[model samples]
Target chain A: MSRNLLLISTSTTHGTGYLEHAEEEIKSLLEGKKSILFIPYARPGGISHSDYTAKAREAFERWGISVSGVHEYDDPVKAVNEAEAVFIGGGNTFVLLRNLYANKLVEPLRHRVLKGMPYMGTSAGTNVAGRTIGTTNDMPIVHVKTFDALQLVPFNINPHFQDPDPNSTHMGETRDTRIAEFHHHNRQPVIGLREGSMLRVKGDGVKLLGPHTARVFLQGQKPMEFKTTEEIHFLMDAY
Target chain B: MSRNLLLISTSTTHGTGYLEHAEEEIKSLLEGKKSILFIPYARPGGISHSDYTAKAREAFERWGISVSGVHEYDDPVKAVNEAEAVFIGGGNTFVLLRNLYANKLVEPLRHRVLKGMPYMGTSAGTNVAGRTIGTTNDMPIVHVKTFDALQLVPFNINPHFQDPDPNSTHMGETRDTRIAEFHHHNRQPVIGLREGSMLRVKGDGVKLLGPHTARVFLQGQKPMEFKTTEEIHFLMDAY
Candidate 1:
C-alpha cells in the first residue's frame, strides 16, 4: 500500500466556484470511488460541520458521488477506517488539527491514506497532510497538543503562496520571508503552492500540477521556482 | 500600581524609519526613564538577538535613552523584575513566547508589567501583551509551551490588521473573517489594531491612540470601528 493523494493549495480561486478549477483532477482521483468521507473540521467562514459537508456534497454531486461528513458518524475513527476516499476541506489549520486530535482520528486517517485510500485536501487540509502545520498561513485561533500532522508528504505545504508585489506598500512579511523564518528553526523543506497549484502523489512518484510555478524553500538556501512540467518527484526523497 | 503600557501595531510603516511614527509616544511613555530593557526574542528575518537589540538601541539613541538586551544578562528573570522600563520588539510571536517560556521569564515579566512597570511592545511583542497569542498574524515557526500571554489587557490584540481590499483579486481570508472565526471558539474580545495605531494603557483606562481608527470584534456582535478620540476604555472591563 502506498500514498494516493491530490493536495491542492486552495479549493476556489478568485471568481471561481468552489472546487471548480480542480473538478477534472477531483474526478480523475475518485474515478471508481462512489462515496467520500468529507472531513469538514476546517469549517471555513465559521460554518457548521453539517453545512460545510453539504457544500462538499454539492460539489461532488456533479460527478454523482455521495459524500458523508465525518462528524455525522458516531465514531469518526471508524468512519475514516471504512472510508473509500477521504476529502478534507480548507479552513483554520489549528482548529482542524485540534478536532482531529480530540476525535482520535489522526492515526486512523493516516493509516487509511497511507494504505492506498485516495486522499484529497485543499489549503488548510493540505497543510495537515504535510510533516507539520508549521507552514500554515491561517491564524492560530486555537491550540493543538502539537504542530504534528499526518505526514503523508515529506515536506510542509504552504498554501495560497503569494508573490511579493513590488508596487504594494503593505509592510507585512511576505510568504517567502515567513517560510525562510520557519527554516531558521526547522530543517524541513517547504513547498509554496500558489493559487491553482497542487501536487499529485501515487506510490513513489510525485508531480506538480496546474498552471503556476511553485516555490521550494530549503534550509540555508535561496528559494527556487519550479514549473509543473519539471521532474519534481525527487522531492519525495529529500526528507 | 496600575498598568502603564504602549502597545503598537507595527514598528515601522512604509517609507519611515524604525519607530519613527511613534517617537513622541515612546518618549512620553518613557519620560524620566534613562535606560530600558529590550527583549529581542522575536528575531524577525532570522536576525540575531544582539543585532536586534542594536537596532533598538540606535532607534532610542535619538532620545538619549540607553537600551540593554535582556538576553545579554545572566538572569533574564531577575532583569525583567528589576527593569525600570521593558520593550519587546516585533518579529515572530511563537518564537518570542517560546524563548520567554524556555528562559522562565513569562511569570516575572508579566508580574512586573502588571505591577506598574512602564512596558512597550511592537507587533509580536504587542500580541503577547494580550490574553493570548491566538490572534497573531505571524507564522508559527516554533511551538511554545502554551499560547498564554501576559494578560495585562482584557482582550486579544490583532496587530497590523488590514481591511479587505475591494480592488484586489486575492482570495485569502480577510482579517475580520479570521478574527470572527476565533470568536466561534473563544469568548474574549479582539482589538484589530491597524498599522500606525497604538493603545495607551494607564491604570484602568485604555485609549485608542494614533490617526487611524481601530476595529473591535465581539463574540455575538458586529465589528465596530472607533476613532482615536473615542472613549474606548470600556474594552478594559470586557473580560
Candidate 2:
C-alpha cells in the first residue's frame, strides 16, 4: 500500500476559525472515511484531553465525518493500529511526543500510516510526521525520551513559518535564522510551511497546497522560497 | 559555602554593543577575579566555538578580566572546577546542554558553582541555570541527553521574554501563553526575564536587576509583573 498524508502548517490562520482554511483539502483527503482517530495529546493551554477531542470532533462533524479520540480508547496502541484514519491536532510537540512514547504507539502509528491508512497532522501533529521534532516552535514543556519522530516524510516540516517583518525591531532571532541554525547541526532538509499552507502527499508524490510560498532550508546553503505551484517532490530525495 | 550567580536575560539590547548593557553588573559580579571561563557551546548560526569565545573574550577584556574558552581545554571538567568564574554565552539551549552532557561536565560544573564559585550566564546560559531547559525559546536543532539543567536556581527561567505585539497578525503563541501551557504539565514557577534584565543571586537570596519589569508565572495563578528592585528571594522557596 502507498502512503497518504495531509500535513498542515496550522489549524487556523489569524482571525479565522479552527481548521477553516484547510476544510476543502481536508475533505478531499479524508473523502469516504467514516471517522478519524484524533490524537489530542498536544492539548493547548487550559484545554482538557476531552475538550481538545471535542474541538476536533466539532471541526470534522461539519463535514459529516465522525471523530474518536485515541485517549478515550482502552488501549491507545490498539486504537492507533485499527484507526481508519488518524488526525493529530496542534499544540505542544514535547507533550505530544512524550505521550506517544508513553503509549508505545510511535512505531504502530508510523507503520499504519506508511501502510496507507490516511494520516493528517496540524502544527505539533505535523511536526511529528517529519524526520524529528527539532524544528518545532512549541515550548519544550516536558521531556521526551528522544527527538526522533515518525519520519513519515523525508524532510522536516516547520509549520506556521512566518517571514520576518522588515518594520519590526525585535532583536530576537527570526524564523529563518532559527531554521538556518538547525541546518548547522542537522543535514535533513526543512520545509518552512507558512500559514494557510500544507503538504499533500499521496504515494511517493507530494504537492504544496494553499497560496503562500514555502521556504526551503538545506544544510550549508542559503534558504530559498518556493511558490505553492512549484514541483518540490525532489525534496524527498535531495538530502 | 554559598552560590554567587548572575543570570542575564540577554547579552545585548537592540543597537547596543555586546554585553554592553550589563557590563557594570558583570564587573561587579566578578569582582576581584582575574579571569573567567567561557562556555561557547551555544554557538549561534554559523559561528565557530573559537569565534564565539573570542567575542566573549573581547567583551570582558575591556574590563581587564581575561577569558579562556572551556572547549580549548583538554579536560573540560577539570577546567570548570579550577576556573575562578564560569560564564556561559547565549545561543541555542539544546546545543549548549548537549555539549555539557557530552563533555561530562554538567555535574562537575554544577558542583563548583554551588560551592561558592561565581557563575554568569546570558540568554541560553541563563535558561540552563533553572531546574530544566523547558522554557527556552530556541529551536531544538539538536537533542540533549536530558532537559535537566544545572539547577543552580530553584525555578525555570524564560530568557528574552517579550510581550505580544498587538498590532501583528501572526497567530503563534506568545511567551506568556507558552509558559501557561508549561504550567499545565509542571508546577515550577517561570520567571519571564525580558531583555536588559537579570537576576543577581548571593547565597539563598536573589534580587531582580535591571530597568524592565519581569513577568512571573505561578502554576494556576495569573502572571504577575515585578519591578527590578523588588526582592524575589521567595521564588526559591515557592515551588
Candidate 3:
C-alpha cells in the first residue's frame, strides 16, 4: 500500500486564517473521509492539548468533517487503528516527537500510514513525517529520546523555509546555511517547503503543490529550486 | 571564587570583523593572560575544528594572546583545567554540546570557570554556558545526549535574538513566540540577547554589555526589555 499524505509547509500564511491557503488541497485529500484523528501533540506556542485540538477541529468542521483529537482516546494506538484519517497540526517539533515517543505512537502510526491511511501534517507536523527531525526550524524547547522520526518519507522536510534576505543584516544562520550544516553529518535530502508550498504523496507518485517553488538540498551538490510544475517523483528514492 | 565569563551574542556583527564588536570585553576578561585554550567544537558553517581554531588564533593574535584548540590536546578536560583563559566560539550548539559530552569536558570546564578562570563564548558558545541549551535559536541538526549544559549561569540564553519584523510576511514563529514556548516547560529566565550584545559575569556582579536592549522572558510574566545599563544580577538566582 502507498502512503497518502498532504504535508503542508504551514497551517496559516501571513494575513490568512488557519489552513486557509491549503483548504483546497486538504479538502481534496480528505475526500470521502467522514472524520479525522487530529494529533495536537506539537501544541504550537505551548497551548494545552485540548485547546490546540479545538483549533484543528474548528478548521476541519467547516469542511464538513468531524474531527476528534488523539488525546481524547485512552489508547492512542487504537485510535490510529480505527481512524478514518489523521491530521497532525504544526507546533514544536521536539514536543511533537517527544509525545509521540512518550505515547509509543510512532511505530503504530507509521504502520497505519504505510497501509495507506490518509495523513495530513502542517509545519512541525510535516517535519515528523520525514526520515528525521534534524532539519526543523523549531527551538529545542524539549529533548526527545532521538532525532530519528517516522520513515514515512525518505527525505527530511524543512517547513516555513525562507530564503536569505539580501538587505537584512541579521547574524543568525540562514535556512539554507543551517540545511547545509545538516548535510555535514546527515546524507538525506531535504525538501525546503516555502510558506505556501506543500508535498502530496500517493503510493509511488509525488507532486510539489501550491504557488511557490520548493528548494531541494542534496548532500554534495548545490540546492535545486523545484517549481510546482516540475516532477519530483524521483524524490521517492531520495533515501 | 565567582565565575568570570563574557558570553557574547555573536562573534561578528553585520559588517564587523570577527570579535571586533566585543574587543574591549574580550581584552578586559582576559587581562594579563598569556595564553587561551579555545573550544572550537561549534565549528560554524561546518568548518573543520583545526580551520575553526585557526580563525580564533588569527583574531586573538591581533590582541597579543596565544591560542590553542582543545582538539589539539590529548585530553580536553586536562586542557580546560590548565588553561589561563577559555574561549568557545559560536557555531552549532548541538554539535558543540555533543562534542563537549563526548570529550568529557563539560564538568571539568564548569569546575575551572567556577574557580574564577575567565570564560568567553559567542552565539552557540554563549548558549551552552547557560543552564541548558533549551532556548537556543539554532536548528536541531544533531541528536545531543542531553540539553543540559555547563550551568555557568542560572538561566537559559537565547543568543542572536531578533524581534519580530513588523514588515515580514513570513509565517514562522517569531523569536518571542519561541521563547514563550520555552518558558512553558522551563522555569529559568531567558536572556534574549540581540546581536552585538554580551553578558559579563564577575565575582558578585553581572553587567549587560552593548548598545542594544535585551529581552528577558520569565515563565508566567510578560517578557521585560532590559538595557545595557540595567542591573541583571538577579538572574543569578533564576534557577
Candidate 4:
C-alpha cells in the first residue's frame, strides 16, 4: 500500500522554534493514520539525531499520534517499511545530504515514496524534495561527505519569504536575486513560499496552503505571484 | 590599448579588529604600474567606496604607485577605458554582487578583460570571477533587488577557509558542507581559498597565489587539496 508524503519546509517552524507549531501541522496531516513513522532527515546545523527525534515526539504526542524515531531503529529499512507516513524536518541541508549519502538512503526513500507512502518535509526537508538541494541557505554547518537528495520535485523551494532586512550589513545576494540567478542558469520555476504558507502536493497537482502568497520565479520572465486558494498544476511538470 | 586588472583578497583587515597582512601583496601587484585606476567594485560590507579607495591609495602611496579612484567618473566606460590597470578590493560578497548588478557592469568589465586589460579581484572581488556568486557567507546587508554576478570564473569560490567552529551554536549546514552540496549539483569544482591565497587566472591557465592551501571539492569525490605552485587547468574547463 502506498502512503501519502508530507514535506514541511524548515522555515515554517523557524518562528516558534522547533516542534511547537510543527506538532499542530503534523497532527492535522496524520490525524487518523496509525503507526506514523517519523523521519527527521536533513539534520544540518549540527543537530544530533536525538534532538530531531525529540522534536518529532513532542509534535506526535500533541496530536495523539504514535511516533518513533527511525534513527534509533537499528534497521532503518524496517522502520520505514512499516510506517504509514513519513515526516522530514528541516535544519542544515548539507548535513542532511551528507547523512543521506553516507547511509545510501536516497534510493530506499525514493522507492518507498513511489510505493505511495505519504512523505512530508519542511524547510531543509522541503529542499530535498526539489531536483537538487542547491538553493538552501543553511550554511555548511558540517563537512558535506556527499550531496544526494530525494529528487521528487522538479524545482527548488525558497522558504521563509520575508521582506528584506533594513539593518543587515552583510550584502552577498538576496533570496530573490539568488533564485533569479538560478533561473538564469537553469530554466525552472522556483517556488517562493512565504511564512505560514505551503505547497500541498496531491494526486497530480499542488495546492497552496494558508493565507500567505507564493511566488513562482522563472528565468526571462516576470515573477508570478499566487494566492493560497490557487491550484498550481505546473508542479506536475516539475518532476 | 588594454589596461591591467588587479584583484586583492586580504587575510584580514583592520575593521573586523583583525590584523592586516595583505598589504605587501597589494603593493607587489601595484609596484610598477604608474597610471593605475582603482575600482572598488566589491565593497559589500560597510566599507564605503571612498574608504576602500582611500585604503588602496595609502597602500600604493607607500610603494610610490599613483592610485586614483575611478568610481567618481560619471561614465564607467570612460573611467575603465582611461585606466592602465583596474584593481578590485574586497569586502562583502552580497554587497559586491548587488552593486555589480545595480550598475550593470559585469559584461563591460568582462569585455575589458577580454580586450587584454589587466584584471584583478580579491576576496569577494575574486568570487565575482566565478559563474555564480554562491559561495559567500557575507550576510545580505543590503537588498540589491537582484542576484546578478560577474560570471568570470565558472566555479564558486569559498573565501576564508577554516575548520568548523566548535563554539558556533548556529544550526544548519557548515561552510564546507554547503560548498560540497554546491559541487553535487554543479560539475564545476568549488575551490576553498584560504586568506592570503588567490587563483591567478592568466590567458590559458590559472596559478595559485600566496602560501596557503586550497581545497577543490567535487561531487562524489574526496576534496582534493593543492598548493600555491600548482597550475589548475581544470578552472578553464569551469569557464
Best DockQ goes to which candidate? 3
lDDT of 4 by residue, B41-148 (tens): 555334567887888777666667777776777887777766766766666565577666666666777777767666667677776766666566543333344343
All DockQ scores: 0.82, 0.78, 0.88, 0.07
Instruction: Summarize candidate 1's per-residue lDDT along B1-239 as a digit string, tens digits.
Output: 39999999999988899999999999999999999999999999999999999999999987999999998999998889889999999999999999988999888988888888999999999999999999999998888768999888988999999999888787779998999999998999999999999999998888898989999999989999999957688888876
- lDDT per model vs. reference: 0.92, 0.91, 0.92, 0.64
The window of 10 residues in a row where model 4 chain B has the poorest summed lDDT is B11-20
Give one clash count per candidate, in the order shown: 0, 0, 0, 52
How do the residues B1-239 of candidate 2 rate in per-residue lDDT, one tens digit apiece? 39899999998888799999898888899999999999999997758999999999998998999999998999899899899999999999999999999999899988999999999999999999999999999998898868999999889999999999989777778888899999988898899998999999999898899989999999999999999878898888855
- Off-target runs (Cα >4 Å) in candidate 4 are A1-3, A11-25, A141-148, A166-170, B1-29, B34-120, B123-135, B138-239
Q: Which of candidates 2 and 3 is the stronger one according to lDDT?
A: 3
What TM-score does candidate 1 get on C-alpha atoms?
0.99
Chain B TM-score (each prediction, in order): 0.98, 0.98, 0.98, 0.83
- Pairs with steric clashes in candidate 2: none
Cα lDDT of model 3 by residue, B68-186, tens digit: 99999887788888899999999999999999999999999999899899999999999999999999888888899799999998899999999889899998899999999988888
At residue B141, candidate 4 shows an lDDT of 30
Clashing residue pairs, candidate 1?
Answer: none
Task: Tell how far residue B95 is off in model 3, in angstroms.
Answer: 0.4
Q: Could you tell me how far off, in angstroms, the CA of residue A100 lies in candidate 2 after the best superposition?
A: 1.1
lDDT score for candidate 4 against the true structure: 0.64
Q: Can you write out model 2's per-residue Cα lDDT over A11-55, one digit (the tens) per residue?
A: 989878999999989999899899899999998875889999999
